[model samples]
Target chain A: MRLIELQRRMAADVMRPLSSRAPGVSTYLTPNTLLTAADRLDIYHRQYWLRLLDALAEDFPALRALLGERAFSNLSKAYLASCPSKSFTLRDLGSKLPSWLKADLGRAGKYGALALELARLEWAHVEAFDAAWIPPLDSAALASGPDLRPTLQPCLRLLELSHPADEIRLAANQGTLRREKLSVGTHPAGKYFIAVHRLDGDVFYRRLEAGEFQLLRRLERGLSLGESLAGRIRGLNDPETAPSKLRTWFEAWTVLGWLGE
Target chain B: MPANKFNGFTDLGIGVGLRIPHYDHIFSQAPAVDWFEIISENFMVDGGRPLAVLDRILEQYRVVQHGVSMYFGSAGRLNREHLRRLKSLVRRTKTPWLTDHLCWGSVDGKYTHDLLPIPYTFEAAKITARKIREARDFLEVPIAVENVSSYAEFKMSQMTEWEFLGEVVERADCGVLLDVNNIYVSSRNHGFDPMAYLSAVDPARVAQFHIAGHSQFEKYTLDTHDHPVIDPVWALYAEAVARCGRTATLLEWDDRIPPFEEVHAEARKAEKYLPEAAAECA
Candidate 1:
């Protein structure tokens, strides 16, 4: 078979349910004297999915631990079936998972928020590892003008969640929380915001106030220092008092190595 | 960066996979490790604890890179980004050679992420060999391809896997990373003769050898790399050493990785097969 045809068959085999995909030309064996073509194709097809699912489980142990083995496995199988990976890299596998959870509320049911949160967290971790490392923004540059690096590391992620997902993740890991009775229909009592960033080679997350989250979002969108503060601090009785807050934020950001001038 | 020194192997002998669990012990205790083999993808990132730790390892040991995602046999155009990152890493580590599996990963453009087997046909061999040559030319160094264990075979293959492997390496003028355990695994999986596979490879091009444990299911064995080298694999390694002379050998134990001592012991077992310690020729 031509390479294109073989690839098409392989893609079909990868995407199709196990029993239906066709076997195409393979490099390891000869055609049809012994083992049937379908039987041979089944081996690669099964393995392709199994290995990825296994990797996802391994990478997201806390999520799996929280969901229980049986539930997590079933969910993973369902996820694989619904969204066959398009990228060559397994690291790109979970990119769609958070949105997938949001869209498939019925399927995710009570676990929808938790699933989204876990996906977000896992993506953050992966991005942190591969994210570009830029030298700290020059103080002179920041003072002089405006231009954020377009190729900045994809690590800094913002998550606006309905539930206190970070606490739940921690609680699940510690076995202090049971997942059996969790519900997805109702939102958590209060709004939850988070800032995920990489610091000193480890991925870290901090809960953010509503105002702080908005301020970071504006900054991320390329607003200049003065403009960002103006946009967020409008209508305040004492505008001069915001300098201390800005100073504290800058200090925290510098320590995290997030500032790039 | 000190002109990226490449002194070749200075009587470094065989090494084992530098897994994360044994990081502290290996660095603090300063075990008798001549060289260390690290997965290229695991350390291909910017500053981190992994690099910091690897810096400590590089201080006392020779390091080489072994990668899994090169996908040299893939019909699609080469992944330049991956190659660029690999080159950057090679410069950083000053590795002698970069290695990956001798199997196609994707067709047009979709990576299975597993080392999927390729057919042993003239066309397949030609394409793979050409890609190897291109990769070597691009990277400006030798690229060694390792054989992978497979669960099934394609019916369209015209030649044995060993013949195809030999043809590719010879035609491409590249090196071979003869993985002994994979030979055993493929033999069991496809009902082939492992010795014949070993004998078929050109000894001159065999740059390295890999030994790892596999899990046994009811019908077939899996290259899970979760345990120590099995007895049969060790025997094969001995044979490979006798035939290929003293090549750089690496023991892989990716899953359920044990302590530093255990990995070192597995690596030390290969020492008996290596040619007697000689002067540092380089």
Candidate 2:
């Protein structure tokens, strides 16, 4: 066989799901005293699944926690079947998992919303962990320019989630949340606003008010200061309290260095 | 030619992988280390903590970039974007010479992330050698191909693994990172003499040596790198150093990593096998 044909055949055999029948390897591979061609090929096949599964588990710990081990494994197998990694880095292995979960609700079962939210948060966490860092507007600069645009930091991720994903993720990471005791239906769900950002080489999460979330989203879309405040942001319950809340949010954001081009 | 003259690169002495678990110890303790070998892909990021930590590590010690995803044996066009990111990192680390596996792990655009063995055919060698030459020219750095421990071999392979390796390196005008443990593992699996494999390797082309442990299973040995180097592998290292002279050596412990001191101690064991003068100098 040609080199290309051999490689494609080997890759197909190694990438085939474990539950399926093994690929016919005797034609291409040589058997030894201790192992058959099938047995030898199985080594690579098993490593492929084990390595990818372990990587996904590391990246999406919260989603794994929410779905339980068995369900998470089944879901990951399905996801890998559909979206075999395209990038050279294993870091990009989970890049499309959030969208995959959102698109395949039947596979997600009753915990679709909760699972999707957790996956989104985890994926955002991965992005925020290594996204490029742009220098933030310092307090002195902010004080000097009253018309400064509130551009979001490149590393900042604004999430408007229906489920309290941050809380569940923290709980799961700390071992306080158990899949057996939790039910998606009974969990408290509401509009949860969050900012995932990097500070001093560490990733962090900060809850935000609905107005702050909307304003940050607008800023991330490259909105100018005038456009951002000209009724573009909604969900502020009290119009009278808008100016004072905006002042407080800007002060905290400036201190955290969340505003950048 | 001496080992350093293989590609005009220095023997960087003993080193360990720059893994994350030892970050705190590496930063705070600042222990004496000859060098650190970083997985190039781990730091080939846009910006943030990975780069920050890498910059800090660069400040303290000499770092050599080792990669796992070059996939030069694949019969498709090389990924330009991957090479671009790798070159950016090469500028960052300023690694004397970069090393990647001599195996194919991707087809078309999909990646397996595992080093799959290549068929030892003239066609495959010619294609792999061309890709290596292209990468070496583009990156402007010396490149070395590391032999991978593989379970399966192609029935249509035209030659032995070492003969195929010699053919590719000679054709590409590159260096070889002769991994002794891989030799031991593949030799055992494929029923070849480890010494014969080493004898076939050109001493003048050997740029580095990798000593790692493998898991012994009922059927075959797996290059897991989770345990300490066994006696026979160390003996192989002795013979390899004897043939190749003093070369840069690294210990790989990717899974179930122990304390930094323990890993360092394991890497330090290679000093005994090195030439007496070089051992003293290191």
Candidate 3:
């Protein structure tokens, strides 16, 4: 067989379960013995998912801890089986987890947002650690112009949720939160905004106001300073004088090295 | 060419995988380490703490790049962007050589996020060797491909993995990282003799050695670098060193990482096998 076809078959063999319920596939050996090709292939496929799930759990400890071991394992297994890893590194395994959790099968009303928020927070931490680092845009260069670099570090991620995600995530990580109460239908009211970024070798997140979050989202989408602030400014707002609040926010961002030129 | 002439990083001495848990200890205390081995993917990003910490570590010690995502044996074309970033990282760190796994990670442009094994067929060997040569020529530097631990063997494989490894290295004119723990793990998983695998490797082509730990289940052994190195693996490593002579050896502990001192102590354990490393330190 062609190498690609062989690999696809191998992947399929590894991914399928050992039970009789597994789909019809080619098997060179029976699953009974340790050295059986079926058993060996199963081991690889099992390890493949296990390793990724273990790594993802490690990355999203708060989510795992919040869900309890049994629930976490089941959820992770289902998620992984459904969305087999598409990246070359285990680090990329949980990229879609948060969104997945917020979707129909994943959205267990009460804890759905919390699970997703935690996943997003964890993914952000991984991205911040591994994402390319752009030297913060030079202040002098940005002061002279409004253009932003397209190659700005892709590490910065913004998360908006319908629950107190930051607070709940912190509680989960601290081990003070109880898993029993985090049932599928138990969601709380109120929307939350957060910004996940890396600064000086650390991953950090700060809660954001809805307006502020929108403004940052615009800037992240490559909007110029003037364009991003054009409608957000309040009474007496002008690029030079009236939008003093926006200027302060801009200066704070620049100092934090979040802005790229 | 003589084997000695092909030896790279002979001066690097013994090192351990530079994990994050040891950052503060190595940076603030400046521990007595000969060199540090870094997973290139950890620092492949634009800007972040990992890179910043790596920059600081590079300033203080010798650093070499070992990657997990190069997927050298994949049938798909090599990711040139990935290569460009790696080359840039090499230039920045002045790495003596770059190393990655000898396994295929993706097929038809879809990555599985695991070090998937390749068939030990002559066709597979030829194609893999060609890609390695291309990567080496493109990067303008020698690349070391490490053998990975595998749970399954291809029924179509015509040769043992070690023979395939030896052939690939020789054909590509590249170096072998010779991960000892992987050999032990794969042997246990596949019912092969680890010693035979080591014997088949061309010691002259060996550029580095990796010693790590694995976890065992009732059915098979898993290459999980969570614990200290097992005695049998260390013994195998000693035998490998005896056969390969002195090569840069690194300890890798990824999960449940202990304190830096403990990890360093594990790395230091390799010294007993390397009189050269001992003498250099002495």
Q: Rank candidates, TM-score, best first.
A: 2, 1, 3
Q: What stretches of model 3 exceed 4 Å from their correct place?
A: A17-34, A61-71, A98-156, A178-188, A221-224, A232-244, B1-9, B188-193, B215-219, B226-235, B276-282
Tens-digit lDDT track for model 2 on B3-68?
464445586789999999999999999989999999999999988889999999999889889999
User: Regarding TM-score, does 1 or 3 come out ahead?
Assistant: 1
Minimal lDDT window, size 10, model 3 chain A? A20-29
CA error at residue A52 for candidate 3, angstroms: 1.5
How would you order the candidates by lDDT, starting with the best?
Answer: 2, 3, 1
Positional deviation of B239 in candidate 2, in angstroms? Answer: 0.9
Q: Clashes in model 2: which pairs?
A: none
Which is the better candidate, 2 or 3, if ranked by DockQ?
2
lDDT of each: 0.73, 0.88, 0.75
lDDT of 3 at A58: 84
Stretches > 4 Å off in candidate 2: A143-150, A180-186, A235-240, B1-8, B277-282
Which digits, one per residue and each the tens of the lDDT, describe model 3 over residues B177-274? 88999999988877789999998888778888899988998988888899999999998988888877767889999999999888889988988888
In CAPRI terms, model 1 is classed as acceptable
* Candidate that beats the other on lDDT, 2 or 3, i.e. the better one: 2
